[model samples]
Structure formats: C-alpha cells, structure tokens
Target: GPQIHRRTLLLTAYSGPVFFHILFYYCQAFIYGTTFQHTASQILAFTLITLHFAKRIFETIFVHVFYRLTVSFYSLYLYLFHYWLLSGVFMAYYIYYPGTCSSSISLLSSALETEETSLYFLSAVWIFAELSNFETHLILANLRIRYPRPIPKGYGFDLVSCPNYFFELLAWTVITLITRSLASLLFLIAAGLHMWRKAARKHEMYKKEFGSQYPKYRKVLIPYV
Candidate 1:
C-alpha cells in the first residue's frame, strides 16, 4: 500500500511543475494578449507546458484506472517526440518565410508573404494530428476490452504497443510548425530526448519480461502487424 501510494504521489509531483507553468502562462496570455512577438513565445511556451501536463494528468487520472497502471514510458515518449519533430519543421519554415508582428495582438495578422501557405500547412498538420489521436484512442480501447489481464504471453503483438506516444509526437510536431520560435524548438528537443530514453527503456523491459513468448509482432515504438 505504501509503495502504491508513493508511486501515485511521485506521478503527481513529477507533473506538478509543468502544470504550474501552464497556469502561469495562461494567466499572462489573458493579460497581455497576442499582439507582440513575445506573446507568441508565451503562447507557444504555455501550449507546450499545457500539453505536457494534460498528457500526464490524463494517464494519472484515467489511464491508470482504465488500464490498471500508468503508461509512464508512453507518456514520456509522446511528450518529447511530438515536440522535437514539430519544432524542427517549424524552425525550417520560419527561416524560409520570416515575418514580424508589432505586438502580441497583431501576431495573428496575415501580413507575411507566405501567410496563406503557413495557414494551410498548419491546418493540414492539425487535421493529421487529430486523426492520429483518434486512432490511438481506438487502439487503446480495443486493447483494454480484448486483453484485460496480464497481456497474453507472446500475445503482446496484438496489444496497441505505443500508439499514444506516436500520436502525441505527431500532435506537438504540428504545434511547433504553427509557432516557430527558438524557445519552443529548444523545449521540444529537451523533452524529446528525455522521452526517447524512456521509450527505449520500456522496450527493453517488455523484451526481457516476455522473452521469446512475447509477440514477435509488436514493435517497441510502432504498431506491429
């Protein structure tokens, strides 16, 4: 009981920092608006922070109850991977089509030469992310319904290995593209590295635990056919 309680407390405290940052940034956004470039950074920062906190909170509050344990490795992977890929893409776009805003309020103005292109790209990214998110949830639900207990030995292949991590990465990649700031890019990279390591660890654990019986079908980071 103490171990379980300690685990829960650790999860909550680990995520509390990001949650606090989200609240702080949100309050600042409301007060300052988005007319200035600084506000753009603020928005991006808060968005990243919120996403991190939300992912952790969801896993802590719901996934544990539904799935019987926190998806610790998956959560880390999702948080970092999405941000890294998206931030790189956004940085590239920013270099090619640089624009300036007078203030946070004017940040959304269509004043850049490639405004239309950027908008279209962002929309497409959002749509893709949402689709991925939906698919991931579907997979998770299927796993929980079909395989309730100690995942069948070697049957891990049928389980939704790490669908959430894949989609989570995709979502942040889109976010980085939408808000191409150096700060955002840095954050993404930092988060990505952290998560990648965790994913690797999880992969190793599954392999060791399941041995040859583990579904040969399931890949660590991707879905196994």
Candidate 2:
C-alpha cells in the first residue's frame, strides 16, 4: 500500500476533525441562525475537542520527530473521522436532540450531586493530562538534541514506553466524564484501543533498537504490564 509522511498525514487527519467540530458547533447559526441554543455540555465538548486537535496539530508540526517516516494513508481516513467527523456527528446528534438544546438541559447534570464541582475537577484533570502529554512529547523531541545526556524520566518515561499515550487516554477519559456522553466514550474507546496497539509496537521497537539502553522496567502504556 502507498504511504505518506507522518507529519502530512497527522496534519491532514487532525485538521479534518477541527473543521468538522467547528462546523457542527456553529451550524445552528449557519443553518438556522441564532434560533437554537446548545446545552452547556455541548459547548464545552466543542471547546475541548477543538483544543485537543489544536494541540495535536501543534505537536505534529513542532514537537514530534518522525522516526518511522511514513504510515499508510488509509490511516488518514480512520484518524480524520476518528477525530473530527465522529465527534461532530455525535455532537450534532445530542445537540439537535428534540427539546434538549437549552443550557437548562446540561449534560453535566448526569454527574448527580456535585455537577459543577465534578465538571471543574475533570476539566482540571484534562488540562493536567494534556500538558503532561505535551511535556512527554517535548522530551522525545529533545532526545536527539540532548544525545549523551540522560533523558528526563521525571514525567514517567521510565514507567511507560509512551507516557504520552497514557496522558492522551487520560485526557479523553476526562472529556467522557465531563460530558457523560456515550459519543465521547465511544471515541475514547476507539482511541484507547488504537493507541494501545501502537504503544505495544513502539515498546517492542524500542527494545530491539536500544536493547540494554532502553529502560528495563518500562511497560507499554501501562504499569506492571
């Protein structure tokens, strides 16, 4: 099968989702004017989904270095839909649900009791996990520049083959918790499974490439694996 550079595929893939999310979120105005109001959770999902892809696009351009060079472009369809179209469609479904479009119908209300507190807590966790993921990417990007210098293990580089994947999954889980949306949960599961496989392969590659130099106890996106 034909392949494309990782950077190009990543940019194309993530960019698709960002566009879809924006379109779906603002469709009320575009398609029906300001006549419709979205629930607070819908708006929050829109923001976080946008922010998540924006971060990935930024990392693809500036933070990640391509060791593998290319991957199948078929992955572009899977990833593009995975990020943008899937989220947008799910979001559109919930946002456009009959008589449930008002802020009063907040999806966060699903959390019971501590809705506001829980939303805030999960949001804080999302921010932390996303930043942690970005930090790990920075470490990987610096690995070549830092050369003979010991790589930083403070971010759990020694505990997992891909702390970035763990953090990425954590961020998705936060969104799922905050929205309590089946849609977001579905996306999380898809992403988790995909990253889990990729992480395992990367872990194996690291072992074969660096052997004794790679951290001995490091696992693949999990501890005690």
Candidate 3:
C-alpha cells in the first residue's frame, strides 16, 4: 500500500494529541472561560495519558525502526480520532464535567473507596504492561538490526502473537475503568478492533515467514480469544 513517512506520521499523530491534552488540561479556564478543581481521578487520567503518549513519541523517534513496509493514511486518521478526538473528550467532557463522573472514586461513597483501590491496582498493571511493551519493542528493534526479521520471544510473546497489543489494550482498559468515561470506552473499542486485525495479520505473516517453527498455538491478541 502507498504510505506516508513513518516517523513524520507518528510524530504528528502522537505529539499533536499530547499537546492537546496538556493544553486543555492546564488551560481549562482560558478555553472554557471558567475553571474547576480537578479531582484525583481526573488528574490520574491526564497523567496516565501524558505518560503513555509521551512514551510513544519517544519510541517513535528512538525505539521503533521503520523500513520498506509502511502504513496508510488510515493510521493518521485513526491516531487523530483515537488519541486526538476521543482524548479531546477526556479533556473537554470527562475531566471537567463538574459531576461525579469527573470526581474521584474514593470520594463518591463508602463503597467508592474500594473502586479507588481497584484504580490503584489497575494503574500498577498499566505500568507493568507499558514497561513490558517497551521491552518487546526493544527486542524487535534489535532483531531487525542484525536478523532477517523480528521474532518476539519473551514476556507475553509465548502466549500471544502481539503481547504489545494486549498490553496496550490492558493499559487502556485500566484508563477506562479509572475515568469511567463512555468516550474512553469508544476509544478502547476502536483501538482494540484495529489491533485485533493487525495482530491476526502479523500472526499469519510470522507463520508464513517462519513456517512450522512459529508457534501454531499462539493466538492473535488475546490468550483465550
């Protein structure tokens, strides 16, 4: 397929959204003409997104290597919609909603504190998965350097063809649970579907490229599904 420059497309996609989130988050008063206090949960949402996308920007420039194969304009649209548009909702609607939706789970009610506990647990999981994803990318980068092609081996690789996708989904799942936003759910669905297709495609590629040496039992994106 005809494609754009990988680094240029990725930098634009990731950096644009990160800039939007930071601007909307801090400049709430200037944009909306009024300012409201940010709940703990809202802060967490903003922080996690910033960290996640910043990591992506860094990975795009330094970590991931792109060669002949490249993506279409669809990726540009998908990144903008997922990271920019839906994340705009996180800034404009979800965070500054001035309701329970924007408020911290711990402050909602007696049982809500337990929700915050789960939020903490989820955050931990997200961090772990993010690190693991980075590690996988490093592995791939190294492989493409000296080897014919990349073959993921460690972490969640033995189980899923794309553990990075699984980890990405898991991190987003945590974000959705923490923010409890419908827009976030929509983002999750959109990104998850795209990743599912990509995972299946890559799985087939590995099978054809590596033959029976590639793990036949390895699933696409998830273990059971």
Of the candidates shown, which would achieve the greatest TM-score relative to the real structure?
3
Q: Model 1: residues >4 Å from true position, as ranges?
A: 1-59, 66-114, 130-160, 215-218, 222-225
Candidate 3: give the clashing pairs.
Answer: none
Q: How close is every model to the real structure, measured as TM-score?
A: 0.50, 0.82, 0.87
- The better candidate by lDDT, 2 or 3, is 3
* lDDT (Cα, tens digit) per residue for candidate 2, span 42-91: 56767787899899999999888876899987887777677656655665
In model 2, which runs have C-alpha deviations exceeding 4 angstroms? 29-34, 95-113, 145-152
Which regions in candidate 3 have their CA more than 4 angstroms from the true location?
Answer: 1-3, 69-75, 89-92, 100-116
Candidate 3 C-alpha error for residue 27, in Å: 1.8
TM-score of 1: 0.50
Error of 3 at 75 (Å): 4.7
lDDT of 1 by residue, 77-184 (tens): 443444333333333223222242212322433454354455455556656655565555554555556733344222223553555565556665655555555644
Top candidate when judged by lDDT against the true structure: 3
